[model samples]
Target: MPALKLLKLPPPVTEEWEWQMNASCRDIDGSLFFHPDNERGEAREGRVAAAKRICEGCPVRRECLRYALESGERYGIWGGTTEEERRATRARRRVR
Candidate 1:
């Protein structure tokens, strides 16, 4: 063998996207977004409300909502919107 050459590959890309920005719920318990199936009524409402509050203050709320809608996310609170709210958004989008 006369010579062997190796080509260096560029560094792997690790830039964060807008959707990957720090979230307000980063410090919150994930369980709050995915409450127990047995949880109902006032308890569930309180949990959902708390999660939504975090989402309300999130800087990437719109991106979060878009991600949720595009992914067809059917569970948990996202972008301060409940599953029912997201359903309405989808319906409205379809009408447009």
Candidate 2:
């Protein structure tokens, strides 16, 4: 019988997340970053723009972006970038 191989797992969620403590959006409402159900067009665009504005002054913007890209975060703005922006970045990386 062949021995079963174990899959390598990602690090625990509790690890190296301290940057969140210094984020500019830390004191803001989370709903600002995430849209409500059926939100679309100008409303969603406005919300995303507001979130990115907050991220512009974040002390941990780089770290937040790295985490989002690494974790495949598919919603909300991070590091001043929208979900569409992140998706484009991922696509570019894959092409490289």
Candidate 3:
């Protein structure tokens, strides 16, 4: 009989993720970030503001924003920034 060899995979690289573990918005309603069918005007503003307020005190705000921007998130509030805000940020980054 021939001997069989087993293949092994390397462990994934990890960093300190305690910030995400302690995010303030972790328990909040996700609907607050993605509201009624791309709503606009004062109501949208209020919802975004509410979401941002939660993000403001979040320890993982930077990580969240980096993730959203890198992943090209086209909806909802992340890291205290709205879709339009992220769009502008992307444009600015491109210009630089």
Candidate 4:
């Protein structure tokens, strides 16, 4: 039998995630973007609003949203969007 050949795979692209370095939330507490267990109502909404405020001024906001949407991120606030918001966006995309 002939020698087996190994498939060559390209290295992961780190540059694709470089935008995270410039994200406004980088210096802030991560908890602001992720609700704690048992969190509810106004408290969760307040945290989400605060996180979105930071995202609003982020230079990489669009890139962040694109990444989250493409990666199917299912938790936390990403690119100014809550999990519900991302779900809605995905739903809209499916309908189009």
- Winner by lDDT: 4
Candidate 4: RMSD over Cα atoms?
Answer: 2.8
lDDT tens string, model 3, 1-96?
Answer: 899988998775456445566778888778998979758799988888899989988888999898789999998888889889999999999999
Q: How many steric overlaps are in each model, in order?
A: 0, 0, 0, 0
Model 4, 1-96: lDDT tens digits are 999999999998899989999999998999999889999999988998889999998999999999999999999989889999999999999999
Query: Which has the higher TM-score value, candidate number 2 or candidate number 4?
Result: 4
**Residues 9-90 of candidate 1: C-alpha lDDT, one tens digit per residue:** 9876655344545778777788988778788899999999889888887988887788889999998888788888999999
9-47, model 2: which lDDT tens digit per residue? 987776588889899999999999878999999999889
Off by over 4 Å in 2: 1-15
Task: For candidate 3, report its TM-score.
Answer: 0.76
lDDT winner, 3 or 4: 4
The runs of at least 3 residues in candidate 1 whose Cα sits more than 4 Å from the true structure, single-residue gaps closed, are 1-18
State each model's C-alpha RMSD to the native: 6.2, 3.6, 4.5, 2.8
lDDT of 4: 0.93
In model 3, the clashing pairs are none
Q: Estimate each model's TM-score.
A: 0.76, 0.82, 0.76, 0.87
Q: Give the TM-score of candidate 2.
A: 0.82
Per-residue lDDT, model 3, residue 35, is 76
lDDT of each: 0.83, 0.90, 0.86, 0.93
